[model samples]
Target: MSREPNHRLAALMAEAGASNKGLAKRIREGAARHGAHVGTTHVSVQRWLDGGGIQSQTASFVAEALSAKLRRRITPADIGFASAPPPPAALGASYAASLPDSLNLLDELAQHSLDDGQPSEILLPDGEVDSAVLSWLVSRPDGLPVDAPASRRVGMRDVAAIRTAGQMFMRLDFLYGGGHGHKALRHYFRQEVLPLLNGSYSAKVGNALFGAAAEISQLLGWTAYDTGNHALANRYLLSTLRLTKVVDSRMMGARILSNMSHQANYLGQVSRATRLARASAEGGRGHATPRAMSLFAAHEARALSSAQDYRGAARAMNEAEKFLEQADTAQDPDWLSYMDEAELVGEFCHCFRDLKRGPESVRFAERAVALTDPQYARTLGFCRMVLAQSQLLNGELEAAVTTAGLAVEGGDALQSARFQRYVADFQREVSVHAENSAVQHLNEQIRAAMAQLDDE
Candidate 1:
């Protein structure tokens, strides 16, 4: 299990005059230049320098960072990763054209993870991402009937079990975030859901089965996303889009595409984020409920905000608010039920914060924090961070520190890397004012609380 020291990477870093921390920052900057994001920390750089593995995509980022520093081109091979026959691209990263292909890709991805324990976190190129989005937009939503290819006779009861499990997973995800129960969810998906895809079913049952399978794929994608496993998460979502189309569920596909937009925004792919959000709206135009439409509009607003289009973002939010007012639970899917006033306000707060309208953000952030249900601690906690961040941006240093401390103190063993990044981002921003005693104390409080969460 011991890894040989990465002499090539180390030598290259030395030649480039980059320290571990500096190189890590450069790598992140490199990813950002490609309109993507990577959470490369100094510790991660140390691991790579010490011969620990880097994802193939991340290795490219590393080379890019060195290339920038040394004023020359660099490749993964130059850093020792591609010296042998290069490894294959990340599985499930590209678009799959057929049902069997999508299912097989998902199966192999799961098996690869279960087999090696460390799923490769390789990032895909931007063009591949664009290609997947384009494929989903053009592919037939009404898929050919699921061929009866297996002996197991799937029925309503079998489909119902998966639906019930999906609900349970949703509740747990809200309560504890994506890190909780993901492994078990994957196991159940591989064990209970994948096989059902090939089993015998009536047309009704086949459509129902594909919908259920798509739901699970969407959940798997979300859980992976929550954990900051960006590459894997993107693959899951791509498959989810294909499956949603297989069921001819334009509404579901809209939701899936909006989810993709959300992830793109997170990774700094602002242009793609906007494009996907618009696609979701276009594709779901006739099929989406008002609530679902509201959610879609919110995603559009988010992407526009990221692109710094204040007017466009405001227009989208107005649409979101308008749609939410007309939303009725009677007609909406159960999943869409969560896109209520509180959620829209939450998105409002996020948009305002992104735009640096601190006071407006504070007002909406406060409402989101107050309106969020207590049982959904992960969300409540995130709302608290937003509130703190808004306060900081507004120059309310005291309020910012106290709220951030509480957000951290309230943190439990809930394992969302996104949540951790929220904490880290605030810490990074607040550190500038650390000359103040209160800011210093809050910093200490944050570290202790984070350590406690990590321990648990």
Candidate 2:
């Protein structure tokens, strides 16, 4: 006889705020109290969720924990250790069917947009496609070939179209965050872009398209990561890496790895972040342009800083600087065009700030702000926050408040929760100087802005 599925048990664990480890611990502890010998562990809990049945004695302990924690009676029979039903065929199908159609639609849209020199509209239905299917597609191994002759030639027209789409998606992400516009982008990529990777194109055109698709996938991952959907982000990032490999673009792959490192750092996986960043820097060494190398080194430094390895971070920063000094905009790819001197300075300043090198941080931050575009509000906000913190460290309360105010203004147009957290950090720093008029005013303004955000 087949085993029962543990769907209800999975739901109960989630509702009880029990991680696999926590669930196993609870089971073991509860069983011990009743003088029952059970050898359950986190792995056992995971196995159970994956449809493995436990011994009847151990199941009794799990049931007891669930009953106590959920404040409802739950028995071993209710846990359901039976195998799950097979997933829908459409959900499990390869990209050959779904991806090709999606790409054809996108190609049509692209042609129309290029002809009119206007933004094309794409409205994906909410119900027809399973969100998880896209996730699965991105996670699957990259073995498909591009079948289209026209798509294989990524000309100036294609590049321009990709740039336009990327810019539009970036704007949407900045305005409404990842939740609002990411699905459409993801659907487009899964349906339209992935198929073209294998179509009949020259190596040159195919590689360029691969690079563009990789970038879009990274953006999709960023959106998902920003909104705290870690599993989805990982899938997107993995797909991006796979696409980058098709193009043999180490720099693009490194960038995706750096993003993964950043996500790992934020999630408190410091060791994983460090390892990922190190691997990225190493992988990017020979194939990457100076700008790409510098970017990768900077990412490594950031990860080291997060792990509180000040000396290691400083060394990495120094290497990044050397590469940055060697970088020429003329020789760099269009994707790396945005990594100008100002951005490099900003990255170094951030590293210094993390290491508590206040004076050095302030100097670089001031330069970064001066060189950066005022309209690039997010970067400006970050620079301002760094400057404020540096000034605050140097006991310059008035200067700190002034800088923080600029950060607040710059963050006004940004809807990122991470950016808001930076604002909150600035507010907390200034709140200690409550008696200062400028600080008081800054606090009031921040509060007003937060309130406005809440109302919105």
Candidate 3:
């Protein structure tokens, strides 16, 4: 006979600060968020508490919802796999009260992807609970014993080295594609960086190293996202957040939240995206520089646009512009330097395109294309596609065809599925003017490009 699953639902519930009723309510709410329907009832929740297993599909839903609420990834094993280790001594009331937010945040960060087939928004709950918990966790002092051996003391020099290496990796990643640089960076981090974190460092040195490691881990997540590996990206992101807590860098934590907001917007979770972006803006208030603030505002505007809140979006954009105006180059974080006026305007153009404001999109896109570096070929290609779309909408078929040709030329160097979608969109628009030789030729070329992509 098969062994009965070790059901730790009661323990898990306690750790989450959830009464049976609260658990039921969260289940219903989570279901609704994911476009499912599950009644909130004592009996339904009781089954879970009583150690009765749910249907596989329902289990997945419950797991996802609970994970979201807890802010960490909660596997069936976490609740109780068939055979599992005894609960930890720390798995008590205090731990229970904070577990939900941690699990939820982890889950939210862990599921992002940049794949073409993926939706363009990520849904996140309001930041109220997450901000509070993360703030407290990150602020705690490193409690390494004073009498520890010499091997434990990580020096400032070591921390500096790690930071320098991480900065180098970040620059390379931005210049090359993520796929080109990710593997070596990850390998170095795992082999060289993590061990130092485990060693005996002074409190100050340890915290700095931890912060550096957390930032690098976040870069790994970004690389995974860029490569279309959603699951891996999610894992890396979670690890990054966890490390940030150990390091206590509030600014870094807020930056990660902003990144999550960007991923959510890309995934079509507009409301969730807005919530995350707003949380990022609010959380980073004192800790982040003006450049970081501008980027956060831009993310919120992008989400608001996707949610069809044109006025709200426009207001956010305006605020972002104001923040950008105040940004001092020397004072800004290195990461924020890439987000210049052109990048901000490019985001606006994309937002306008999402909102179907073709003329506005075209105007903004033209400026963005003019300002962006040719080395940023993917971004340039996307701007061209947006311009072509705007021209098509304005009945300038010839102009649209010409712009799309330029986009295609740029696309030839990109390996992104999202970029291919732009090509498809351009082809669809050109199909209306198929009687024109230029349109016909462009369509044939697009089809041929798509065929080549398939072979690759």
Number of the top candidate by lDDT?
Answer: 1
Clashes of 3: 31
- Whole-model lDDT per candidate: 0.79, 0.65, 0.64
Model 3 stretches with alpha carbons more than 4 Å out: 1-153, 411-413, 425-440, 443-456
Model 3, span 1-456: residue lDDT tens: 444433576667676777665665566445545654333344555655555445343455556656877788887657754342331222111211232343333333333222211221222234533544355444563333332565555788988888888778776655444554676776777667766765777777766777777777788777765554443554455445555655456677677777777776765667767877887888778877778888888989999999999999999999899989888743865555678888888888888887888789889989988988776666777778888888787778898898888877654434543455566657755776779999987877765654443344
List the candidates' TM-scores in order: 0.81, 0.64, 0.66
Question: Model 1: per-residue lDDT, tens digit, 335-386?
Answer: 6666778888888898999988999999999999889877778888888898
Q: State the lDDT at 151 in candidate 3.
A: 59
The better-scoring model by TM-score among 1 and 3 is 1
TM-score-based ranking: 1, 3, 2
Better of 2 and 3 by lDDT: 2
Error of 1 at 254 (Å): 1.0
User: lDDT (0-100) at residue 268 of candidate 3?
Assistant: 67
Q: Residue-wise lDDT of candidate 2 within 176-221, one digit each (tens)?
A: 6665576688666666666555556655665667678777778877
